[model samples]
Target: MLSEMKDHQSLMAALSENVLIVRMLLSVIFLPGASAGCGAITPVLFSTTPNFMEGLSGSCLQIPCSFNSTDPRYDITRPIYGVWLKATTAFNVTPSSVIFNSSKSVNIYQLEMIGNLTEKNCTTLFSDLNTSYTDRYFFRIESGPVRATACADPLQITVKDSPWSPSINISGGDLKEHQSVTITCSALTPCPHSPPELTWNLQQDSHRQTEKNTDGTFTTKIQENITLSDTHDGYIRCSARYPVNGGNKTAETAVTLSVSYAPRNTSASISPSGLVSAGSWVELNCSSRAKPPASFTWFWNSKHGTINVSVGQVYSFNVTEGGEFYCLATNDLGHQTSSVIRVSIKDNQVSGFTVHIILKILGIIMLYSTIILLECWFRFFKKPKMKTQEPTYVNSEMAKES
Candidate 1:
């Protein structure tokens, strides 16, 4: 009888202990706000990027957001609806408090929940946003028994009357002649569905694309490939046009391009152009078009070949012999030679009239000498015998007549 009583007591104690353990497990699994192992429940948290957002009054704005809850009962795979409340953190579903609701066909505000709520993506878009929409906003999620508001991580918004200016970027070192570079014009695209139109002053064919940034924003970009030249040294402008409800808003930005290139159109000119007398001084000037000012070197084409003369923009020298002269323009980029020019030189001691007078005097002297020689030959050599015979008959007749 004693053994039987001891075994029954031991079985009753064991059954009581197992019943207590079963009760604890049932409370953990069925009780509201109770976690497994009877641990503390985890609070829902929200994560968002760029807590502050600035937008154009006539344009649109995008809010990138995500949320999570550590409670195992929260099932995201169920039908999830996202809500955006303006100026209030209270979990209210009223029309005045809620600006957007993914479950509703239309909301009080022109807002859309573009993100996949089931995937915990709560990114929202607000179109035709004005200054009245500038306020703090909160996000809320509802799925089955999970209903929570991410009020701790509110998004602040500010709207302005003017639009944001576009930016220009040049890649591939410094701008230089004959070198290809990529010029990118980027404009902020808060609403990816209606990206801003981008236009630039560069005439090259460009490639256009819209990309998402790490900050959860979108940007519309146009890239152009250009081979630089001296003519590219000017201001390049890029403009962004946003299509709003009333009209299009525009903003522009400009960047100056300074291109480095070799000298071009190099030429040398003489100050006193025409004929130059020997032993007279004349000035030669060299000029060229270059990004950095070019250094000038005068060169003379002699019988032996091209020889370097003086080094300067202007060179003055006494004219002794006629020859071809040119100039060489050089810079860090490259060099160029000017066309050859001829410099004429004449004797300074003798004038043109003096040589003409000397030649005329010599011709007159030769003619007079020839006339004297002819008379002398006639008087001294041929007439001595012939004159005697002719004169005898003539003299006799003349004496009789007398």
Candidate 2:
């Protein structure tokens, strides 16, 4: 019993030394494996590999991988078999999802296992990539006491169709109505075998083109010359289409077009009438047609020329005394002056047919008052005098005749 305990202690000491050596090697290279029994290190180990890979769905992709192991025997004659697999969970240390068994299965992809067991290089490649290739692929190996399902760092393969969306760029910063602008739309075609074609939903005609990059990708573009108007101020979309197996896949991008323009057909008007009256409020409104709503500036013309009085779309003032009023409409693009409108102020707060009615009513009241005065004089002093005077004249005539 004592001899067995001594042997076990020696074995533990040797494993401790191996663990320390492996921990040191971790700085330069990744040595991943399990302890062989209680006294030995893992004979087979998986080396470092990429964690992510992206590929076109209809194209081919290659993942460079390699592995290493600690063999005490240093026996190169013994066959070291390797296998590749995919993992369901990224956090799993060992996975059973099998993809290619290098020992038994036929190597359809030539580079599926370019790494020789003797050389310890385990690079892999896949042909005719599709959605099925989208997974985290891992590496496994079989040797002496080292048997692992998923021993290497898995590679996350991303298989996709064409690019997601296109980008549209407008050359002019502030565009105006009737002005022309250049619109360029671009998209990337990952699968060079069938490059995407660019197109636009423009009111005017446009030109489309495609460029092949040295990285085996294609960039599609379109140049559009648009004559902007009020009707063209809205959302515009650009689309790119790439050929697939059965049909073509399309992607779109939308952008807003804001065409700034100077004001047009600007005019000023008064609320009540062009002729104003004293103490009455007169409202002035300035209006125009513009991309962005126009701002109005009220100006009063005098001997010294036009002078700014107010700023807004609407202005109100007491018609204490009036001369002439006008407004100018303006925006980021340009400005426009409205036609002058003359406002004549009367002495009293009366205007239109209202003045005629008031004057007629006053005239009628004066006429009635004059008639009453005359009637009072006839019924009082004047009537008495006439009756008395006529009697006196008759008596005088009779006295003369006797």
Candidate 3:
């Protein structure tokens, strides 16, 4: 009986301990709020097609985004909508999605497909994107329980650098005689999808003029009817200035005009065509052909150097003097001159030279008069006297003539 009683007591103690353990396990399992679980955060992403492509006026651009929910329990029957914000605006965010969905908060953000966002894919687009939206756009995504976001690298739509040498097209053909002409500058490089501004300037004049932007790359002509002057060699240039990813960028090109009417070819020659004797007058008439008559100057190789004969272009030098000489002719266009002439005065001054020339002239005149008088006398008298007198008279007349 004692053994039986001891066994029963031990068994009762074991049963009581097992019951306590079971109760503790039940309390742990049924602890309040234990069933709720925290979900992990997952990231959403965005991308642009062509990543980069040229843009035209009134054109469209597309942006795509992919998203997934962290909590399996969260319903994604509809993906969260996304927003497009301008990077440059001071607004906390860009004017509400330049693109987004119209339906449920969880509905797919579709850019209207007409202008901006189109379908549930979170694929957004921009149409007629103007200068107002010239700034960069980024993506922002939001869902029922979770919000995630991703950004695309800034896109720089700008006019590319122009060709090394650019041709200028004038509204009318190249103008002449100080006439006015309209000239438009277009970029050889294609324009970016982004908006750009085109401008013109004359470097020499420091004149800045704006051209009408036809497209991002082309400009409407600016009429510059100038009463051009020599100084008008001023260079005309065009530039396209626009925004870039890192900052701002610019492209430029230029052209120069040879205003039509110019001075004509000119010449200068010596009358005797070579060295003029020393102390003798040397005439150098500098003559040039031009619409407006040109000016002339005489230069002498002097001790002081090539000295301009302040007098004029026709240089007169006494051949008795020694010097090197030349003549220069000029017009509004330019100037040119004759070859150098060397002059040396010889020591001997021949006084009889003039007398000799005078005597020779007088003798010739006397001889001619005598011949005429005799010819007339012979013609009238010799025929009557006889043909025999003719030979003698003819001989005398010939001698006088000689």
Candidate 4:
């Protein structure tokens, strides 16, 4: 054991170049009544308080830690310096991860250790925490030969991002029209004395309730039982307000309400409603506004038991004579047939054909006018030119001599 102590001292000396390790040795060397060989003292059995805790990002975190030893060789109430280290694993402890060494390096956190080593409390405060700070943390004591560390089962800490809205709990099912349902919204209050106020924006009759927990925290719950109707099938919101510096901070949550019902407001229409001809194109359309869009079925009225033409929103085909056409819209709840629309198929040349024939005659007249213009241009304005005779020079004088 004496040789082992010498080897430990040599290893400590070799690592003295690191400021953290040097500070750790100084913390141990400055302990009260630690004036003896380093190896003569016994190690301590250390354990932390509240083996696990949760922290929120973008906020300050406090870990209340305390430890004591089972070994009778040490006194539990004495002022023994400590070294706090953070590690990924508790089995293999290393010296490079030392966070702080009391009596030498202070102010490693936002505030100095709020714990008293003489009282066996090693609580620490970390400020402006972020997601990357999730890990296991433990403490170590290095006074004389009593150099000890606790990492086998260090404290587990998980960090979460700040929540945007309050938690909303709803209890109901199978929401039909005119149904009643209960909804509750809750928000956490860090202060017990001042509970937050809750309100629902849907203008429903709601009640507010608050509870005080044993951990000095408060919870505000707002509940409402409302008869849901067509007007209630929109965004329903709940908000919680808490007092701040001079005003208030509020958080809200919203949910869309969907109500199921049968098909309603059914109607049918023909594309060409006024006039039609035999073997002319026409379309019949059926529509309804329903929760789960209703199915459509088209029918053409005839003496032979109303022939079922098709099953869809639109039916298009050529019609022979004037007939009756309608459609049926059905859903899970109920079904309804639209009012019959009488289609008039003109067998004796409808007035629409006269307009079409007039348009055709106008087109033929324009074509003939264009042909006449071209022929007149060729006969008069576009006539071929005749060849000109060459002029005779001094022919008059030659004629007089002959």
Candidate 5:
């Protein structure tokens, strides 16, 4: 009986051991997972490239994100890729997305990897970035399972300030008809990389301009030589342009130019009402109008001569004889001649009659004067001679009587 009892105890112990073994196997198959194990994937480390920078319009922007996985769990089924996108702003209503490749292994997002990535920085640009595209945005890598994420600070395209209105700077105000003029356009821009071009909206007839270098401020001047015409008046415009944030920016200014010169209008006239007499002192006057003082020269009959006069419209001189007298006036522009004037000399009509009358009066006076002289001679010396004669006669009678 003792031997049988011992045998049962042994059998029971063996059965208990077998049941414990089965329970242990079940725990391994269907129990909760361990917090740390061999198949568990470690978090991947990732960093965004070009953390901070700037870029221009219509240019490519690069966003670099490098990732490292310790468990090597990434595959074609699920890629650790990112989405390059744009945030909504005043000009835009929806957020736009540009997908980089679905590969988790690629390190760079070039211009081809995303929608027109035109800027230099990690920004994806559309063909036309309107004013509504100004907002904040960030890129995200896949998370969990493949389970690694890197977020770059919000990215935004900086719109450079457009250039200011262009203005004209001239060296001088006055020019001759076919003379040259120099004009410079002033540029106002805040963009650091690109320069702007200048052009004229409305100008006179065809002209040629020369470009000259200014200081290091990217300023250049142009010179133009042209014949001045009436069409060069009214509003004139100068314009400048440059690129900005996937778009174009332009500026313009309006101005009016007044050109002054000499010999615009010229004229001359005579002072006397009728023709002047030959061998008489007469005045020949000449005058002209111009910006500066106009020069005057007198002419007899297309013959060159000079005249002195005051600084006024009229120039006068003594004319000994007049056939045809004229004057030539000149200024910086050109010269012109005055119309001809005729002059004549006439003989006196009553001159002979006046001389005959004076001769007759003189003859009458001479006859009266001769008669008075004879009377005076008879009264004085004639009387004395008669007295002497009477005495002689008395003496002769006395002698005869004696």
Candidate 6:
């Protein structure tokens, strides 16, 4: 009887063990929350773009998000709902913590779940966001028997009062005159549905486009192909205007262009402009507008055609003769010739005065000599007759007195 009782106890113990094992297997198969020993529940995983994002105070923001679960109980075929919680990881839905809920017809904020919930896309758009909306947010997925929160990763958003400045880029070598280049201005587009308006100060045939970045962000760009000139050597500005709640926010960036070109407006001038005296010092100046200070070559249009006279910005020499003079300005890019200037050279004033004095003295001596010769001829011819006339006048006066 004792052996039989021991056998019955052993059978009872074995049956108890079998029951526990069956219970564990059933739990693993039916219950999604079942732990190890039979099966382990897989955690829900989340994939999101740009862990951090920036938003304008009165504008909107779009978050690119997707999620998946390795557990078989998390069915994607069933109807799914998404929830966004601010500053809290607890899955418990509350009026204060729940900023967005797909099931609710009306929520706390202006939000929309644009992504398809059945496809596991949790992308959401939050509109009329201000500084208050800047916080860490958590995503939750609820589908049938599965309810999971992506607590391992969260998105941190920063909202600012002003919009971000646009960026400017230039391609195809340094800016040079007559060289073709592409200039692009790009602005960040956090929400593709409401992209910022991009504009630039340059007036050219431009192309505008909105493109998606690899990091899931969108950018609106305006580009133009330009052939550089000296006139383009100034500041170029690009501005981005975003539509906000009350008004519009604007931000701008500027870049100064230093375009290298040859020489322009080349000209030559002479100092003491009127008539250049012979044997006197005269200066010929060459001037031009150039990127790199241009080198000058002075030329003289003599009887031998154009001849190189000197090489420098300023040329000084003793004026020997008069002729048409010009200058050539040259740089790495090209060369330009200035308009011809006529240089008039005259005899020195001092020498000319000396010659005039000598001529006057000669004229005076010749006149004096001619007067002496005439007086001598008059004396030789009429002296006797003059004495006789005086005597007759004296006799006539005496006779009248008598």
TM-score per candidate: 0.70, 0.48, 0.31, 0.45, 0.31, 0.73
Candidate 3 lDDT, tens digit per residue, 340-367? 7665444433445667889999999999
Whole-model lDDT, model 5: 0.48
Q: Is 1 or 3 the stronger prediction by TM-score?
A: 1
Q: Candidate order by TM-score, highest to lowest?
A: 6, 1, 2, 4, 5, 3
Q: Report lDDT per candidate.
A: 0.81, 0.70, 0.49, 0.70, 0.48, 0.83
Q: Candidate 2 residues 239-357, lDDT tens each? A: 87766656677889999888777788999988898556678998999999887888889999866887888999998988766778899898887899999887777654365468899
Candidate 2: regions farther than 4 A off: 1-130, 136-163, 171-182, 225-234, 242-249, 258-261, 273-279, 289-295, 300-309, 319-324, 331-333, 341-402
- The TM-score, computed over Cα atoms with residue i paired to residue i, of candidate 1 is 0.70
What is candidate 5's lDDT per residue for 241-307, written digit by digit as tens?
A: 6565556667788877655455544555666646554445555566665544577765554234543
Candidate 4 positional error at 234, Å:
4.7
- Estimate, for each residue in 208-251, the C-alpha lDDT of model 6 and write its tens digit: 78898887778999998889999988899999998888788999
Q: How far is each candidate from the true structure, as Cα RMSD in Å?
A: 12.2, 14.1, 20.8, 20.7, 23.0, 8.2
Clashes (N, CA, C under 3 Å) per candidate = 0, 1, 15, 0, 13, 0
**Cα TM-score of candidate 2:** 0.48
Report the C-alpha lDDT of model 4 over 116-226, residue by residue, as the tens digit: 877777766666556777777777776555667664337676665643366777678887666788767887644323456778775555666777544323467887777
Q: Could you give candidate 1's per-residue lDDT for residues 1-402 as a string of tens digits?
A: 999999999999999999999987776576543432212222374657577888887777887777776556787668888887786434333667777779995587778888887778888888888888888777777778877766556778888788889999999887889999988999988767778888888874566688999888889999888899998888999999988878888999999999999999999999699778988999999999998989999999898898899999999999988789999999999999999888887563346667888889999999999999999999888875644454434678878999
What residue runs in model 1 are displaced by over 4 Å at the alpha carbon?
A: 1-43, 77-79, 88-96, 303-305, 346-402
Highest lDDT: give the candidate number: 6
Clashing pairs in 2: 115-121
